[model samples]
Target: MEKSLLKQRLLELKYNNFQDLDVDELLPLMNAMLKYIGDTDPDLRDTLIYSSFSSLILEGRYSNENLRKLLVTSVSNDYLFYGIGRRQDDSVFKRSFSTLIIALILHVNIQKNFLSLVDMEEVADRLINYLEKEVDVRGLVDEKGWAHSIAHVADAMDELVNQKLLLESYRKKVMQTIINKMCYDDDYYLFEENERMVVPVISILRQGTNQFLLIEGIRQIAEDLREKYSSDEKSCLIYRYNFKQFLQSLYFHLEAIDLCEDIRREVKKALKVINQPYYAIT
Candidate 1:
């Protein structure tokens, strides 16, 4: 497939629209198109991604297994993180979101086989780097609608954690990143997305050998919440929900650990205080 021909066919297929088509007719063409896409051009790479997943989304898990296997194998962590397609004016965060979305789809659908094909540490390391670079931490959405980039990273991390694909040493770092993000913003949308990562982050702690990381992170969060509540005018917003969920999850995990009694006492005391009203007339 020449570059010009490949681009033309992609534009043609994409423009022709996603309608009900005979699988026999569409499968071969899509497979061939995916082969030519090989991760060089960002625009075409994104198109290839959309092409790969559109069927599953629109027609219920429709995908060419052999072709998708080839496609997933070709996806590189560098491409996902740094991205080859970002324009001069475009946001890298926004661009990386699409690539990660494609990676998430492949990961969910392919499982360990996909993990076997890629460098799990490299992928996790790059994503953590992106999280650090992220200052705005806004969701892909604007007033127009859903962008889902920031949300996608959280979801991808959740997937990685659930699969036990992230290495143990790096797990604590990932957990810290998420714990920091727990109270990073007040936007309900972003906060809600951040909250989705909490369960997986907690899961890592439960499975990890290090109790200090979990205990310390939870204590800090508890203190953060106590400080937030001290301010009468601080609109804690989604932090209210985040705080409750964090305590519940932390307590659940703390019960399974034998050495964190002091931390537990402090957490339980904070929970009691938070449960009480700001002003009790009784």
Candidate 2:
């Protein structure tokens, strides 16, 4: 289908509240949407395509089998990992938007239980690997729209950790991955990337991750920032500032939530370490 025709059809579907569409009719549209999932046009990609997927999934329009197919396709190279290693390019749209779709699938699965433990584990593994390789941390491109790769993957991880079938080990791995991404040295996250990243941390904490391990993750972030503080390079300073903001934001988030006293205290201690001056007071 041509892009213009697809947009018109999607607009009509949206106008009618996405109702009364037969499965056969919707499938073709869905396939077309998937093809343009990485389109640089914000109206088509975000407003029409992603919003349509979210509405259909939340409305239970797709069957379990269909949802599984969507999940698999979203995680595939054509979508989530498309042009993964390249930085500051249009391909980030595909990868970032794919994570949002995966997140919607995971959210629905938590209630419906259509996905298996193995399925969830694969998602965790793929997401962690994606984060490790993803360098395009661009949030909102000037003309193209949002390419918030880190924030989008964080949303997927947040939903993934909430699955009852997911293993605790995977949760630990997810937490560590989040920390590593927050401390990424390539670029600073001006988007609410830190806030989105914290959602998964809260999810894992609610699932009862080992307090010691959680504290250790905090310490590791602090230690990393300390090492960077010793450097006078401009990039090192950017990393230091970004890392400190994440810790501060996390501290406040912990304060608002209950049953996180130990982790909160550790974060507080780490903040103090982060705030220490490089030179002694006169």
Candidate 3:
């Protein structure tokens, strides 16, 4: 393509509102440009592809399938969206980073009309079902796949509850799922050196109301699951991390707690402990 033409095409992208564009015309143009990015020199390829993906995402022309394809293609092209492994960020940072990103992405997706609460539940179900299918003959665990899918489900549930779709019945169902996973968490150390697998169980514990009764009920479930799942003494960091995660989502449990200012203020304290420096949960 002529340099002048390429420049013009890039300029057009800034103004390319897919809602106004003819999809038939735009998709082909996008495809051609994407192909061109592959031929570009390596140094400049990242800039081009990133620009292109940003444009496509902003264009409102892409759906979940397109985003999935984009992720696969981008990674195949050598994008590392990798994070620290379990041994690395022994702090709660990585888990929160993963779960929090999932939550933000879901928020963005819903705003972009690519997904809904119901759609998210289906995604969660599909992810778990996929992991279940990948298990071995004895129905033993696949730790890696389980962790990945469980994080996905937890984020989806967080979004569902945030959106008010996670009613009492659905909440019960989610708790049961985690409860089932307890046997595995107990059987395997899961992570080396006493790092408890905290996200899923913490998530279940967070489903309670703000009221003392509900909070107590949820705490009991958590204690039971902890006993059922964890063999070692509960890791304090893991406990704090789990506590903070629940605190991060504490608003869901607020209906019951609304009656007490003292309890409500305590939620803020919990958020302080759990929230990232840059952003508080509230």
Q: lDDT scores for all predictions?
A: 0.54, 0.87, 0.40
Please write out the lDDT profile of model 2 over residues 1-282, one tens digit for every residue.
899999998898899997767778877877999999999999999999999999998999888998899999999988888998998889999999999999999999989999988888888899999988999998989988888998999899999999989999999998888877777777889998999898998889888888777688779878777656678887777777777777777878988876688877888788777666654422
Clashes of 3: 5
Can you write out model 1's per-residue Cα lDDT over 41-68, one digit (the tens) per residue?
5566555435544544334444445434
Off by over 4 Å in 1: 1-93, 102-118, 140-143, 163-165, 185-191, 205-212, 224-268, 273-282
The Cα RMSD of model 2 versus the native structure comes to 1.6
Q: lDDT of model 3 at residue 19?
A: 38
Candidate 2 colliding pairs, count: 0
Quote the lDDT for 76 in model 3: 27
What would the per-residue lDDT of candidate 3 be over residues 121-196, giving only the tens digit for each residue? 6545532332222211111123211223234334544554443444455555544444333223222222221112
Q: In model 3, what lDDT does residue 155 have? A: 55
**What is the Å distance of residue 87 in model 3 from its true position?**
8.2
Of models 1 and 3, which has the larger lDDT?
1
- The number of clashing residue pairs in each candidate reads 0, 0, 5
lDDT at position 236, candidate 3:
38
TM for candidate 2 is 0.96
TM-score of each: 0.55, 0.96, 0.35
Name model 2 segments beyond 4 Å from true.
278-282
